[model samples]
Structure formats: C-alpha cells, structure tokens
Target: MEFWIIVALTSVIVTLAVAWPLLRAPKKSTELTDDYDMRVYRDQLSEVDHDLARGVLSEEEAKQVRTEVSRRVLAADASASTSAAEIRIDSSRKTNLTALAVMAVFLLGGASGTYYLIGSAGTADQPLAQRLSALQTARDNRLSQKEVETRVGNITEMEDKATDDYKKLVAKLREAVKQRPDDLRGLNFLVQNEARLGRFAAAHQAKSRAITISGSKATGTDYTDLAELMIIAAGGYVSPEAEAALAQAFAKDPEDPRARYYSGLDLAQNGRADIAYKVWINLLDEGPEDAPWIAPIRGQIADVALMAGIRLAPPPPLAGPTADQIKNAANMSEKDRRKLINGMVRQLSERLASGGGTADEWARLIRAYGVLGETEKAKKIWGEAKLKFASNAKGLGLIKEAATSAGVAD
Candidate 1:
C-alpha cells in the first residue's frame, strides 16, 4: 500500500510538471510585436512632420517620409488585426485538456501497469542483516551426516559394478580389519579399500578408529582424511559431523590444504562466499598443482568469486600426470611401475637439488617420495624446503601441504 502510494504520487508530480506549460493560456506574442511596430511607425510619422516644420526637409521629401511611415503603420495595423483574428480562432478551439488528460493517464497508468506486471509488488525488503540471519539459520538447520547419507541413498552405484575379484578382495580386507581392529596398518588398508568400493561410511569409521588408536600421535592429515570420508559418505555435503572433524584438523594444523579447502567449501555452502573466496584464492596461490584439493578448488573458485562480487580470471590449467601416463601406469606390472616412478622421482629430486626449483616443484618432490613409502626422504626434503622457503609464506604453505600429505608435517 505504501509502495503504491509513493508510485502514484511520483507519477502525478511528474505528469503535472510536464503538462503544466501546455495547460496554461497561449501568449499574445504576435499581437504584442505588431503593436510595438505600429507605435514606432507612428512616432516616425510625427518626426517627419516636425522636420518639415523646422525647414530641415523639403516639402516633397517630408511628404515622401510621411507616406512611407503611414504605409508602415497601416501594415502594422493589418498584421495586428490578422494576429487578433488568429488568436480569436485559437480561443474558439478546444484547450489541450484532452491531451493533458491522456498524458497524465499514460504516465500514471502505464507505470502502474508495468510495475504490476514485472515488479515484486508485495514483497518486503530483504535487508543485509535479515539475509545474513536467514543464511545463518539455514546453516544451523542443515542435515547431519547420517541424515544426508540417508537422503543420498545407493552411494555405491558405480562400485557395485566392480569385478568379482575386486569385490572378494574388499570383503577379505573388511574381515581382516574386523579381526585385527587395533592394527593401524590393517585399518588404513581397510579404509582405503572401503573408500574405493564407495563404502565411505565404513571408510570413515575405520579412519576414526585409526585416529583413536594413534591418539596424541594423530596428525591433521588423519582428521582431514576422516572429514573427507564423511563428506564423501554424505554425497559431498559438509555435514555437522564432517565439520567437527574438519575443526579438529584445523586445530592440528591451520595450514593443512585439504582441511582449509573443505573449510572454504563449508563456508560457501553456508552462504559465506566472501570469506570462502578469500580462503580458496589463498589456497590456489599457495599451491602444489597436483595437490588433491587443488582441482576441485580450481573448478569452483570462479563461481565462488562471482558470488563474492569479485571478477576473477580463470586460473591456468595445472600441470600433472597426463592421461597417457596414467593409463600406462595402470597397465604396468607393480615392480616395473615402481621402477619408473622411482626413476622420475630421482630426476625431479636431482633437478630441485641442483637448480633450486619453484616451491611447487619442491612440494611435488616431497609428495612423490611420500607416495613411494620413503618417509625418511620425504621428511628430509620437507626440512630442506622449509629452509629454502623460510621467508616466503605462500611457498611455505605449498610445501606444508606436500609435507602434510607425506606425513612429515603436523
């Protein structure tokens, strides 16, 4: 009602402003101009008479001047009469009342009609505080891990297509872990296999047990892994349980890349895109290109940036293992593959040691050694990287991610 009142008042004011001039009586400008000309010509005629009387002009010259002035006076009188007739005719005609009425109607009615058709006529204003409060409420009421898992049923659609041999192997691993619950190695193996089989709930349970067994020795990576598994189990939702695990991971290591990435995701999910954009952008800048979290961050950061009202250029593609290399590794015998990977790792290590590669390269080397089960080598390279990038915060962050993945950093 208030909106309509304001709109109606504005339309009326604008219409009156525009139509005010047209609504007034027309001016007698033509008549006034003719009258002034007639008066001037009459004065000229009188001057001609005076000149004749003062002997300043010949009789014939005076007569000629008088005739010319008289003719001009007559012409002015005729013009004034014509102008008066035109004015009388104009007065007889109708005023612009109809046109003014049409204008007012168009201005008021057209605006109201258009607004009624397209505008949010009855909606209330959503102030910033209200919007933020609503988002906070949504975040508070978001589904829990179990609830989300229940909503996203049949999480193993793809895993159900696994070959008989793979299924049997996973079953055997599950039984082994069940029998040797305290064996961290078996538990780790069970978590990996369960995740591969799309049994993320089981994987997270195994990971939780592993974290409990390690107790004070558990790293941020361990908690991050558990959080990641919970997210996967919930079909990518960062549920409350997953958020708690992520909080634990952050408590362990603030710069843990996986934990930080998931934290950003949680923020984004909860409608805090501004903070999420900053978090993800820092992660992108401080990156080992092959970090597991890097790909997803790259994929979604542009959208998050838009939500945060930032215009972000798409990041350059990351350099990583090629499809052909991955396919080749899949075909290689385990021994041969290990030899190939070891050769590659040796080359990278030598290059970094001799040429002092970028932080990304140093981080990659650390991750590679970790994957090769060379914890001592990974730790040594991590130490060297920390010294090499001592003053560089971004470089140190990247190196820390690799170190975390390699179990060489807290």
Candidate 2:
C-alpha cells in the first residue's frame, strides 16, 4: 500500500508539472508596434520637402507641414519600438507553452495506456513469505500427475543384436549373477548387461532385486536406479512404478541431480516448459558443481527459459574424461581397477544427473558400472542416456549395446 501510494504521488506530481506550463495563459500578446506608422509619417514629411523645393507650396506652408509630419514620425517610432520587444517575448512564451501541452498529453496518455495494459496498477504486493510459499508450490507443481501420465518418456526398445563374443560374455555374466543372486555387484552388472542387450524386463528385475538386497540401506541413487529401469522397461514411459520410484528418490533427497534433471525433463516433455525452466534453474543453483546434467540442461534450457520469461546464459562447457582416465582401468589390477572405475562412474553419475555427455562417453560410463555390477549407477546412466541420444541413431545403438553388456539391456 505504501509503495503504491508513493508511485501514485509521483505520477501526480509529474503530470501537474507538465500541465502547469500549458494551463497558465502566457503574458498578454505584446502591444502592437507603431514602427510602420512612424515610417509613414516620415514619408509624409519628405513629400512636403519635395513639394516646397518644386515651388508647388510657399515656404511657410511647407515649414508647418514638415514640422507636423516630423512630430508624428517621432511619436510613432517611440511607441512601436517600446512595444516590439514585448511582442517577441509574448510569442516565445506561447510557443513554449504549446510545446509543453503536446508533451504533457503524450506523457499522460502513454503512462496510462502502459499501466492499463501491462502494469500492476491496483494489485497489492505479495509479502516475501507468501511469495516464497508460492514459488515452492509452483516448483513442486512442475511435475504434475497429468504430465507423469501423459509424457511417458521417449522409451524405445533396444533391438540391436549382440556380437558373438559379447553375447558369450553376457551369457557367462548372467549365469554368474544367477549363481550369486545375493551378490550386489553381480545383480548390478546384470541390470546393465541385460539392458544393453534389450532385455528391459530382466534389467528391471535385476534393479528391483538390487534395491531389495540393499533394503534399509538403499540411498536416493538406489531408488533412482529402479525408477529408471522401470522407465526403460515401460518403453520410455514413466509408469506408475517408475513414478513411485522417482517419488521415493526425491523424498530421499530433493536436490539429487538425477531426480531434479528427470523431473524437469518430464515437465518439459509434458509441455510445461515454464515449470521445467524453474526446476532446472533451481537444480543449477543447488546441485553439485560440474555435474553431467549441467551440460544437457544448458543445451535444452534456451527455449524453456524464454517460455518461463527468464534469460539463460551458457554454462561453462564441461571438460570430459581424459583419454588416459577412460583407458587406464583396463590395465589396472583388480583393486586399482575398481577404485578408478568407481571414481569415474561416480563422477559421471553426478555430472550426468543434470545431463550432458556423448553417446560413446555415456556408453563407456554405463559399461564401466555394468561390468562392476553397480546396477544402480548403470540404471541412472541408462535413464538419462536415452534422452541425450534420442536423435542420434548410431549413438543410441551404442548406448543399447552398452546397456545390454551392463545387464540394463532394456
């Protein structure tokens, strides 16, 4: 109320300031000049002199006429000279007043029109507390039930045939996981390798089993894995099961990059770019730095940001894994290989949570985890990888292969 009052008062003051100049009548038009009349009297005196010189009038008569004419000329000059200056000043004042009137009309009309069309002319300000609550509500509403139902992801079933050697390796790995069903690593690997081979149902099964084994110890990432596998198994749709899994993951950690990214992506897919933009912005602000999702978010945000009435700048390009880092694990001993592989996988998981990476890189990272039986991590990678490579036929194929090799073949 106070703020509005101030705005109203300022507008009034400006209007009056403009109107005052135009409303007041200028000083009365300057008295008419006598300069022309004075010139006429002088001409009469000259005529009298010429007549006398031509002997058309006697000297006495000529003298009287000349004196009268001279006196009239002097009177005319005195009066007109005094008034001329006043006329100019009066004209100038009227011109200035006219200008002010034109400006005032434009100013008042423009301000009023703009306020009527776009300004919050009569609304009260929302208090900070209320505003914050509204913001949270809006952000939470970004992922709607309708959206969850309508925007079943671009879940394509992988149908690529595996090579003979990889198929043999996969068969052996599956047997190993089956022999030791309690083996967390085996279950994890089974999920990825099965997924890569397009065994989506198997992948989902392995993921659920992995989660069950973790039981009370399961983390946000754990549920995220199962939810992702559910999405894949459902042909890119976020099924009720997948949505339930996502809810669990979000409940565990709202700021988890994977949850945030997928939630925003879901909103975007459902034609709620406005909500998605806000979700991504919040994710950018609160998620871990240099997370993988940042890259993809940066790539996808421009259109959504525009819809959301926000400006977006490109986030700094992420530096990808070094050639040696990607290859070093191959030559490492079992313990060293596990440590490097996990480190890279964790980094990739976090980075990708926001979204960015090539198909090959995504494939490699998913494969790394699939080999290690970290079904949960491979599931996260597979969920986002499908989105990232949706447009790239070759890349998508590579991802499918890696998903199968990792046992996440769905």
Candidate 3:
C-alpha cells in the first residue's frame, strides 16, 4: 500500500509537469507564429497612412477604411493566436488536474483507512512489546485450541478401540510429544495414563525425556508431583536418589504447598509418624484454610491422635430421644417426651464437658439426636463438632446437620 501510494504521487507530479508545458506551449507557439502576420498587418496599415499622407488617395477614404481594417486585423490575429491546439491543451490540463486531485483523495483516504484498520488490531496505546506479546498469545491460543480438539478426538478413538489400547494411546501421545516436544499436555497425558496402566517405569522414562527436551522443563512443584506419583506407582518404594530428587525440588522451592503436603505423606507412609505429625501440623498452619488436602491432612491427624490415645471430650447423650427409642418416645405422652429430652441432654452435656469421647462416638451421638428431631440439642452438638472436626470430615457431620437445621435449602 505504501509503495503504491508513493508511485501514485510520483505519477501525479510527472503528469502535472508534462501537462503544464504542453498547456503553455501551444499559446506560446501560436504567438510566435502570428508575430510575422501581425508585423505585415502593421506595415500595411503604416503604408496606407503613408499613401494617404503623400496624396496617393483622398484623406476621407483613408479615414473611413482605417477603423474597419484595424478591426478586421485585430479579429484575425485573435482567431489565429487561439488555435485548436491551445483549446485541446487547455482541456487536457483541466482533465489531468481533476484526475490528479481525485487520485490524491483516494490515495490519502485509502492509506489513512488502511493505517487505522491495521493499527486498530492492537492499538498504539499499547507498547510495542505488549502488542507483540498479544499477537503471540492469540496465535498460541489458536494453535492450542486445535491441539486440544485433536487430543479430544484421540481420547475418543482410544475409548472406542480395544487392541492394546493403552499402548496405542501411549504410542500416539509419544509421537505427538516428539512432534511438539515443548508441548506439556501430550507428555503429561502420556505419563498419567502410563502410570494408570501400571507402567510406572515407562511413565518415569517419558517424564525424564520431557524434562530433557525442554531445557527449562522441570518446575519444582511439577517435578516433585510427577516423581511422587511415579514412586507410588512403582509399588510405594523409592531409593535414596529418588528421595534426593524430592529434597532438591523442595530446596529449590520450599514454599510450594503441594511439595510440603506430599513430603508429609511420604513421612507418614514410611512410618515416621513423629516427623509426619510435625510436618502435617505445620502444613495445616501454612496451607489455605479450605485446602482440599486438609481433609486427608486432618484424617491423618485423627489417626495420629488414635495412635497417641488422645481422646476428645465426649459428646452429650441423645437429647429428647435416641434413634432406636423414637417409637418409645412416640408411645409416651407429650410430658414423657419432655422428660426424656431433659434427662438425655443433661447426661450428654456432662460427658461432652468431661472429654473422653472418640471421633466415631461423637458422630454416632450427633446422628442419634438428628434422628429424634431434637434439633436444638443437635444444633449445639453440630457447632461443637465443626470446631473439633474443623479439618476432618469425620467430625464435621454436624456441619451438614447444621445446614439442614438452618433451613437454608441445599
């Protein structure tokens, strides 16, 4: 577009230059051609005056014809000077100027529109680096979308086919990884599925290859995660070297919560409950309040508590009625129901405050209250359960009960 605009402007200049000379040349040429004629007419007029002055003819005849001859000579000169060439040149110049103006308008207008249209894609308000980044991002997104679609198709094919299906999937995924070694999706899928099929060694090999392929391939968190999964798939055994890998990853990035969580799992699995207990307790302190890992983390804590024989405060007995005593309560009068509830609540309250109930016992006690519809007593138990089981689901049966009791509608 820029090249064409320059060419057009150059052409316009050339046209104007060529046409200016042509338009002016005709008039100049006509004047030169008529010079001799004008000179002859002037001489003839002078000769007539001379003839009349020298008594060659009457003064009256000279005077009468002088004005007429002068008029005819001026008219003839005007006709000769303004020739067809001059009229044609003048008309051509006018046409050329009109064309040049039109061309200028179109060239500038088209260029301006094109400039803005191209510029509007990113906008000048953005830095050049940012524009380039955005362009790369958009291109990558398009390519990634296509890749995901292809992978979905591959997954469908794998689902439908049955002949060494897992191996075939791995082969295809390996080929894709080879085609785009930097692509994490193919490598990750390959490793996960290989592990799923109990091919831990192969998955480890693929992960190692991927780590080699992309120079900056192994992130601390991802590397530890993959290595740990490999170790688990390898029948829960790993060498000192494998341990060193996790230690190195943690050293490289100590702040990664997953690394911390898995480290605790490894400690627990290896029967270092003391170390595991310490690690998990610290993890609970450092991790997000609602981390899903907390469920397993708290379960481990409860297991530790059981190992140490640390018992929680016993929950109150069933208030109002027991689940099995529902018919008994129904058979009794309204007064009996109130008496039964008061006795149960008092006994349960004493036990809960005394602190000797196991986790399971608390769950059963709360469930008993719920079955009897002693909701007020159940709600109290539920609140206490939430605190006791803040991290573990076992103690949190009360939260569900609490929600139902509040009538907030699931």
Best by lDDT: 1
lDDT, each prediction: 0.81, 0.72, 0.59
Give lDDT tens digits, candidate 2, residues 1-410. Answer: 67657766887799788677566654544466645676678778888889999999999999888888878777777667767767776787778777877786778677767877898856768997887687656655544333543445323444344577887888999899878989998998888888787666678778889989988888899888777666555544455466678888998887678877777765665556788898898877775666766766654566567766777665555566689876876788989977876776787666655456556667888898888888877876786677655434566788899999888867
Off by over 4 Å in 2: 1-13, 19-75, 117-128, 139-154, 159-190, 197-209, 216-224, 227-298, 301-386, 389-410
Count clashing pairs, candidate 2.
Answer: 39
Model 3 Cα shift for residue 202 (angstroms): 3.7
Local accuracy of candidate 1 as per-residue lDDT tens digits, 209-328? 999999999999999999989987776678989999999999999989889988998998888999999998898788777666665665466667887899976444335567898889
How far in Å is the alpha carbon of 271 misplaced in model 2?
Answer: 14
CA shift of 254, model 1, Å: 1.2
Candidate 2 residue 112 Cα shift, in angstroms, is: 3.0
Residue pairs in steric clash, candidate 3?
313-355, 314-352, 316-348, 317-348, 320-341
TM-score for candidate 1: 0.60
**Model 3: how far residue 295 lies from native, Å:** 2.3
- Order of quality (lDDT): 1, 2, 3
The C-alpha local distance difference test score for the whole of candidate 1 amounts to 0.81
